[model samples]
Target chain A: MTPLLECRSVTKRFGGLAAVDDVSCVVEEGSVTAVIGPNGAGKTTFFNCVSSIYPATSGEVRFEGVDVTRLAPHVVTRLGIARTFQNIRLFRGMSALENVITARHCRTKAGVVASLLRLPSQRREEAESEAIARELLAFVGVAKWADSAAGSLPYGDQRRLEIARALATEPSLLLLDEPAAGMNPRESQDLVELIRRISKRGLTVLLIEHHMKVVMGISTHIVVLDHGVKIADGTPEAVRNDSKVIEAYLGKEDVT
Target chain B: MRDRIVRLLVATLAAFLLALPVASLRGNSSTGFTIVWTPAFVTAAMVLVGGAILFAAVEAQRRGTAFWDARAATDSAVGRRRPCAAQAWTLGVLVATVAALPLLGLPGAWTKLLLETMVFATIAVGLQITIGMAGLLVLGHAAFWAVGAYTFGLLTVHQGWNFWIAFPAAGVAAALTGLVIGLPALRLRGDYLAVVTLGFGEAVRWVIKNEQDVTGGDANLPGNIVPGSFRKPMGALGEWLWQPAAVDGRTFEPGTVQALIDRECYWFALVLLVVCVACVHLLAKSRVGRALFALREDETAAKCMGIDTTRVKLVAFMASALWAGLAGVVPAVHRGSINPEMFDFNTSVLFVAMVVLGGLGSITGSIVGAALLWMLPALLANWFPEVQEYRYLFFGALMAAMMVVRPEGLFGGARRKGAA
Candidate 1:
């Protein structure tokens, strides 16, 4: 079967530096794939390329067998690839539910005239969007914050709210960048369970995380990178034992 | 009880201090400003200070605490789903008051001021869509207003079109102009976009000013004779429905007929204000409104959430321009002539100030802001002619004070909160 996402030698260059250099990977359907690396390992850059935030300099990114390399970020989202930011980027002034409802913008079809007139079709769509947003908020365990401003929510809840917002797009593949960065052990554990629940629902997830426990605990596949280059790709156990992965994480073993 | 008395005393003193500028007069060269101390000034000061103290005491008694403590107010009303009945009642009362003003035998000058205020209110509400909702600081809004006015002026004077046809044509013309400007300017953000729009506004005025024969340039449009075609006469249907006893038997007195016509015009403007307010209120609660709010908060997140930012911004621009265009018709018809100077950068800035003073995203705030800013100077001029030169200085001070005291504005309801 074809993979859900395929990146062929994607290279993103900024001036003279290659943030993501000639890296290729495939994300299979119905699997939680984790991209792990130390600080400045280009994990977030790789995700940006796939989401079309930057668009790879010399590569093709295929989503569900369609080339979406040059598509706008919003178009990429509409094509069933949604992503969260490394630093939580919620609509700070808007209510939590409004943030999710905004994410359902592409899914709803009401234009200015319909909205202005408050046509029956538009009203129905609005109601449906709200219902979906509320349900997603509950699923991500931030239901109580649905009415609060997204900015005022606690850090972990903010992370979960971002996930709920991404899921609102009804994406086939959800990309989370550093979701557990500021989360505590208990929060990361809860996040692990959340990812499992998401995967169980048949949606593929592509995540960039530094927390080894959460990464090893939930991801079915692992891709390791260091210095903008992919060094290992396999199951969690295989990647855990790879010498290159170990050397990248810990400085090279010195022999005197 | 002691604290309440102390608070009232402090508030009264503060009110007295704040009223000093308005109660005093400036002297030439040698002597600085001096307190007027006239019977009228003293009486006014007494009334103001007394009113402030009375209000504080009453409010404190009712709320059972310091009236200044806003946190004591319940949050149940903040994000409630129901439409606020108090707001509706306030709006109804205000509209009825304005509608009755002309019929109650208001002087011609006051009627004209009221009519002008309503026109500015409509324009301010329209600008709210671009500046408040979409968070695009459009400094050239008057250009769209000018476009609308010129469209109406040209169509009626040159093309000889009926008022009904020209009105909508004016709106469409302005909307088209908005689209043209929005296409290139929407690519810029914040201050750069503001400067570009400002330039566009000036460019439009220059074009109208230089076009001489076409627009009458600086002299005003329909230069020779103010066309009677622009005046929307109460049709046969209107005359048949209600013929006043004063005009029923005798030949029409020009003054009586003019007053009746002005009343009709006032009602027409009031109706337009209602429609503009309702449309904006509805739009604010819609999907496009949510997208605008999201865009204002964060563009990248909004884009990632699948919003077409450019399209949304353009929609706001066109919508706002459409209203300004529609509002442009009123001035053209009311004045019976259009001048490029009427829609200059100063007018644009005035509209911007109205939006900002009223509260960025508040619909009612825009109307209130427009009414206060437009009418206050005129009212002051009528009551205290001696302070004429200080009018804009007072306005500048009032706006600066408002910014410091309540940047969110008098009726800003943009910030949402959970039950606290």
Candidate 2:
């Protein structure tokens, strides 16, 4: 099957420093792909390039054979790619349900006049959006806090809510940036199950994770990066034993 | 301790500034036998009251409390949901009181004051859509108001058009102008947007002033906008409601005709206010409203959620300007004239002040703010007409004080803190 997402020679430069240099990768349909690296490994930059948050300095990004390298972030999202931020950027003052319902922006077709008039079709769309948002919030286990402000939720639930919000977009490929970052061990274990369950839902998952256990425990395919360069790519077991992957994590001589 | 001292100093300085006019006028009176004591006592009273507020604010800040938690008080007083039986009862009572006030033999001036407040309340409700809900700070609202008023005034005077026909036409004209400004202005955010909009207001006034033939220049159009009688077919309802009687060479009842017309105008304005409030309230509860709130909270995150931020912002601008446009017709309809001066920067600032004071994003808050501010001057005009002249200065001081003490406004919405 054709890859769901393909990044060819993607490079992002920031004033003399190449944040993501000559990086190329493919996310196959319905597969769980993990991109792991050290602190400055360009994992987030690579994601940014693909999501069109930052246009790649060189190279192309194709989603299901359609070139979307230069598309705006919202346009990219409309093309079935949704992502969570590394810093948990929920609409702070909004309720959890609102945060999720807001993601249905592209899916819902109600305009200002229709909404103002409370047209039957608009009301139906709104009710449906609300129902879907509530279901997603429940799926993430923060359904009880649906009416509470998103920022006021506990840290773990906030992360879950972000995931639920991303899921609300109904994207084909979901990109999670450090989904397990700052999460406790138990939470990370739960996140692993969640990712597995999400992939089982027939959606392709691409995630950047620092928790080795979560990465090794869930990802079907692994690609490693170090200093803006791709160091390894294979199945979890093969990538785990690769010399360069080991060298990238630890010093070369120390690994030897 | 330091904060208290700073507050004390600021309060004293404000008192001095506020008293400067009174003090300067005291000795400058050409007639040396002026009643200076009344002015002096009023100034002192204002200073003392202002000092008390400053001290209280300082105490609240020191105690690490929500210094501006008026939202709780207001929420309790006017319950958020309108459909609640108690709220509905209260609303019915309020509406009845307003409707009956003119018939109760109240002074004509007071009725005029109430009508003015309703007009401003309507305008503020429109402004709340953009500034309060959409998280946009538009300073050119008065320009749209001016455009509507001019359009209405011109069409009525020159073309001999009826009031009903000219009203919607004026609104559309202003909306077109709003589109013209909004397309370019929406690209800039926060202060830049404010500055550009401010420029738009001045630009509009300048254009009107230069277009001497059409707009009548700075002298203003005269009293030609004679309000046409709301005629209905001779039927039982019309006979019962508006029975024409011959008295003192007039077809309608002697003194009651003018009073009835005034009452009719009041009713017309009231209906418009209710419609504006209902529409704005409904819009705020809709999907577009939620999208606006999301965009206001975080543009980038909203974008990642697939919101077209530009389209949203532009829509907000146009909608807001549309309200101002509709409101612009009121003054022309009421006063029967239009002038470039009527749409000054001070008018724009007053609308912003109303939004900020009422609580941004809260519909009732905007209405209350506009009503309170408009009524304040009307009530005080008989006693201190001089104070009415310095309205903008007072508004500026009030806004500054609000920023320090109650930045979230009276009925707090989202804590709008970020500059961008």
Show model 1 residue runs off by greater than 4 Å. Answer: B1-90, B225-232, B236-257, B414-420
Q: Give the TM-score of candidate 1.
A: 0.86
Task: Grade the docking of candidate 1.
Answer: acceptable
Q: Least lDDT summed over 10 consecutive residues: which range in candidate 1 chain A?
A: A87-96
Least accurate 10 contiguous residues by lDDT in model 2 chain B: B73-82
Q: TM-score, each model?
A: 0.86, 0.82
Where model 2 places Cα greater than 4 Å from the true spot, the runs are A254-256, B1-82, B222-261, B386-397, B414-420
What would the DockQ be for model 1? 0.48
Query: Per-model TM-score of chain A alone?
Result: 0.99, 0.98
Q: Ten consecutive residues with minimal summed lDDT in candidate 1 chain B? A: B71-80
Here the TM-score of candidate 2's chain B is 0.73
- lDDT of prediction 2: 0.74
Per-residue lDDT for B1-420 in model 2, tens only? Answer: 564454445434433543333232222112221224444345443543444344335434443444443342222111122244444454555465566655544334445556777878888988887888777898988898888888877776677666677777888888788888888986788999999999999999999898888877896763223333432322321221211222234453323544445566576677778888878776766667777878777888888888888888777777777777777766665554578998899889889888878887777668767866776655455447779788767767877886786577655543544311
What TM-score applies to chain A of candidate 1?
Answer: 0.99
Clashing pairs in 2: none
Error of 2 at B161 (Å): 2.7
